[model samples]
Target: MFNLFKKKANEIACPMDGEVIAITEVNDPVFASKAMGDGFAVEPSNGKVFSPIVGKVTSVFPTKHAIGLLSDSGAEILVHIGINTVDLAGAGFDILVTEGDAVDLTTPLAVVDLEYLKEQEKPVTTMVIWTNSEGKEINVQLGKSNAQTVIGKLK
Candidate 1:
């Protein structure tokens, strides 16, 4: 029964499949400067985006550029779809979840038209940030990432 009741991994999951780049490498100052929190950006290989954790969908930006999640432990993760794609006014994006929805790692958050974004001259660098990462433990791998990959554990 002990093994059955063992705690699940407390790690952040990849919201999309792509190359994971350090937040410091992101072009946006709000993200790169760790202003929002410590996380990474992904140069997405595809258009589909998934939820990074089992949490409550805190907010879905009206522009459809980002989704904010609040984990059970009160951690916040912001998954930004692109760099300044908000200018597109939700044209090239399709949000699959609504605010207050409980989502899991396998839940589809949104679908993006990467080609449209590319044609619009928008950089599809998705950034995932943990907003309150002041003095906590985070151990996420920075490299190639897949949907099921555990980016890192946070405490």
Candidate 2:
């Protein structure tokens, strides 16, 4: 029998093409400690960052180094591009979306200049974290990924 009150699960797509790794493996202590929340990281092969969930844009940092999304299933996701890249002050990032915009897996969140980050010696491990997940569970399938890859699910 189907349950009417059960909330449907939401799929999380890979935000970029790269090798997906455990969140604990991220170099940033804040992310590695899960002090922010749990999710995965990608050492990207290219510059494009896509949406990993279908939701409304909660916030896009002025530096264009991070974007926040509130999933339809009630999960808050923060897509932070590059470690310590924030200190660059948006020098090599291109913000493609704005707050309050509805975005799906195919939506381009931003474009990072990989070479610039490399020249600046910034770690280009992008993180997709759940900022506020107290009673929910997330299942992530880590490894190689592309923009449309189903990397995880929010339940």
Clashes per model (N, Cα, C within 3 A): 1, 0
Give candidate 2's whole-model lDDT: 0.89
List ranges where model 2 is wrong by over 4 Å. 1-9
Task: Please give, for residues 25-55, the per-residue lDDT of candidate 2 as tens digits.
Answer: 9998999998999898999999999989988
Predicted candidate 1 versus true structure: per-residue lDDT over 7-89, tens digit per residue: 24366788889998888999888888988898888999999999877678999999999999987777888999999998999
TM-score of every candidate relative to the true structure: 0.91, 0.92
Q: TM-score for candidate 2, please give it.
A: 0.92
What is each predicted model's overall lDDT from 0 to 1? 0.86, 0.89
Provide the global lDDT of candidate 1 against the true structure.
Answer: 0.86
Q: Report lDDT (Cα) of residue 120, candidate 2.
A: 98
**Worst lDDT 10-window in candidate 1:** 1-10
